[model samples]
Target: SRAEQSRAEQSRAEQSRAEQSRAEQSRAEQSRAEQYLSKTNAQCLKGIFAIAVLCHHMYQYSGLFRGKFGIILQALGYLSVGIFFFFTGYGLIVSYQEKKEFYIKNFLRKRVLPFYLFYLFLTAIYALWRIVLNIEYTRRQLIQSIIFKDALAANSWYLQVIIVFYIFFWITAKVVKDTKKLVRMIIICSMLYCVGCFMLDVTSTRYESFLCIALGTMWAVNKKRVDKLLDIKGLQLFLLSIILFGVFCSTYIIVDNLAIQIFSKMASALAFSSMAIIFVFKLSGRAEVLINNPVTQWLGKYSLEIYVIQGIFLLLRKGTKLYIQNPYVFIVVCVIGTLLLAIVIKSVYDWIVRKCRPQVVNM
Candidate 1:
């Protein structure tokens, strides 16, 4: 009787252990699924960061929100741009992978042409604004603005950078057949671009986050390995990202040499983007609801428009009656006004495209 009781106890212990193991396995599977950055998730993040970029410009140009908070927000602006670059690189690779030959053939028409047209439209608007304001300029200056050699609006540098990168991406795709070699070439090109910017004495903002584009390409090309690293429990991954971000920030602060400092800043931006994505992935319950909602998705849809148009308001608010004295009211008006204008501009751009080239509508 004693031996039978002991055997029964042993069997119960083994059953409990097996149940625990199964539960752990299930949790791991769930975590793996949650860790994925879906298209919607990426768009949501772009939406959030787009707003951050707006606030960054608001604080920088308007001189609102002074002190530590202002400093933090200004710093976030570059990080926001870096995230955008990351998405650009990631999205290009993903699309190319999916439609290899088709994407390669139509890269310029599908990608570069639309952006260039929209940019030209925006530029014309800016030029009109100058005429209305009686800000005199020569014919040569006007020609330069139209040709993208100069800009009529603030924060127009980004448009040029995006156009160049698109061309670079298309060329690289054409020349490089191997995926690993393609990614390597992209990284090298990005590094050279940064160095050129530095040598030319371009503002740090123009080049600091360029590397993140390459980082995105690397992530997509080696997604299997990257996902393996990301396969830990959600909480663990979140904490690890936090630690890495901290290290990156510290590295930035401690570095004094100019070249090293520039590289460190780039590294910091990459870490910042990584941390943001990880935080979104690990978020649960109510917090998750806030991000994954329609409002953010809509913002993401018009993110580029919002980004390009906000500078107009920024310029308007300075030395004009349109300016709001109170920071709170100004922010609200800018956000609402910018969103309305962005929607209208995008709709008009879409209509023009449909009217001009009905056949390319699906593209």
Candidate 2:
């Protein structure tokens, strides 16, 4: 009897060891899976960022189509902002995931400085245009416009919001390492937005919608929930397309009546952005074949510069009315002209960067 009891105890011990080994192996596999997902997440989002912005630009400037297509384009424009925010959050958090020690100078020099330089350059261009057109300009207005204060009035406030959000995100992310705290920060910003609405005396503009997006991005990145969405298939995409079209049509129908209402842009922005996130998840990996093409990827690299210059091109066209006989034709010419100019400028910029790199290394 004693021998039998000892044998049974030994059998139980062997079973326990096998279970432990299996559990460890499972954990190892999960870790590898998470690492792979993280990599794919970043790559997938980069293309989405490019496409979403492109969609928005097309809707805004290309009046080639009207009615349902127009509404769809406009909705896409809304979704583009959300896609950008998601990428921004995912990218920034992932970058800092390994290292928490913040370098203010490096961040400013690399990330923020280029934007300031571009802002100044663009502001100067606009100032020259205003002078040529003999449009009355106040010094204060010029300063505000350059710094993004007058963005609400300018109709191109996204740039201003981007600058502020980048800085805000960098600072908050650097200071608050805890994921839970980061989420709280987002909630706080959102609450402040609500309070600002109730007070009505608050000076912040609607362009500050970046706050919600920043929070959303931060939350999503830390949660590592991208895999939850990996199984989104074609049927899901088709359904999403239907829902997006439905909201877009309904919104358009009401837009004329709501022209004067404050929430028009905000509501549209929210609805479209939601649809965009869903659509982006469906479309992310599929674009790799196209975006991976050398020329396309090169264009994608310089796309942001193209985005900044597009408004200027439009302003020039509007002022000249050079192609106004047919708005559709004019839109086509404007797009082609912008792309050509963007390529030329990017080429020159790349050349300069390449030349300077060798000299800087020697120094």
Candidate 3:
């Protein structure tokens, strides 16, 4: 009996040591994520994707992508949003690093509050414009337009999906401490997205954006290994190959099956977005000036407002008689004008918030 008790104690001691080792490794990984993606890095990512999605939307409205070469251009919006989700996942880890427990109220308070304020302001304008134009509407539709993302537009569905993901990630982070299981969770979510596409005959970002966000979380969890991989010999060639491969795969759009099409689009988006973000990360210190330009800094700071403000500008363009036929000229002007107007809106919004709710605004 004494010998058996001694053996059991030895096994328990070994197990405890193993668990301690795992906890240490996790702490190191968390530290690495903070190092790899600082607040500044997050801002750079937002600025890049914001301008890109803005351009993609411009092309969509301008009817610029209408032929053999247009599919690649058409595919960029998906890629851009995928990258945006990547940062969103990383951002959650950084922003909530100090929290001892997952708090849904805190997430809603901090994550959704500012955006919801802006959303209420902008979408009300959209609704009123609809009302003035005598567009057929109902009380139900008005309520839906205010609350449901699908009621707003395809692009605007991002807000709904991202908010859902904020909650999802909070739950996941609280429950699953290991990175391996997190990867599996994302893959499962992707499979569910595919099933939803099959059943619904719809393939919106609503179904697919979670995959990218999961990829982002995986990256944050394994940033130490990722940095090491970047330093491997012949990485430049590897980078080039992935970029070309990603672009080539993105152009495959000749399918009748919606499920297959959605699958392909997800693959294409992941390939292209992963390549671009990894490449930018590879640049490290060299791209600082480009990323930190005064204009870029401003764009990053108010990127969300820029996104919301574009709709207002689009409405203004629709109402006015300024006809710019050339897509490039129109996009250039739209970008410049939107940036200027968004800056003004942000300034005024900040001033008002500081006067009334300083803690909420600056928080």
lDDT of 3 by residue, 83-117 (tens): 78778776665444445354433555556655555
Better of 1 and 2 by lDDT: 1
- Considering TM-score, where higher is better, how would the candidates rank from best to worst? 1, 3, 2
Candidate 2 lDDT over 158-275, as tens digits, reads 5665667668767786778775676577557755664565467434344323443654555455454544443335346547655754665566567675332324444445444445
- Please report the candidate that would top lDDT against the real structure: 1
lDDT of each: 0.78, 0.55, 0.64
Once superposed on the true structure, which residue ranges of model 3 sit more than 4 Å away at CA?
A: 1-36, 65-69, 102-105, 131-137, 173-187, 233-251, 254-256, 316-333, 344-363
lDDT of 1 by residue, 1-363 (tens): 999999999999999999999999878765645545678878888888889999897787666779978768878888899999998888888888888878888778767877778778888787777666556567787678667777776567788788889998889889887777888999998999899989998889889988889988887888766666665664676677678767866777687788777777788788877777667655633367567789889998888778888876676556443545776777777788888898998896776555444264465
lDDT score for candidate 1 against the true structure: 0.78
Pairwise lDDT winner, candidates 2 and 3: 3
Alpha-carbon RMSD of each model: 4.6, 8.3, 11.9
Clashing pairs in 3: none
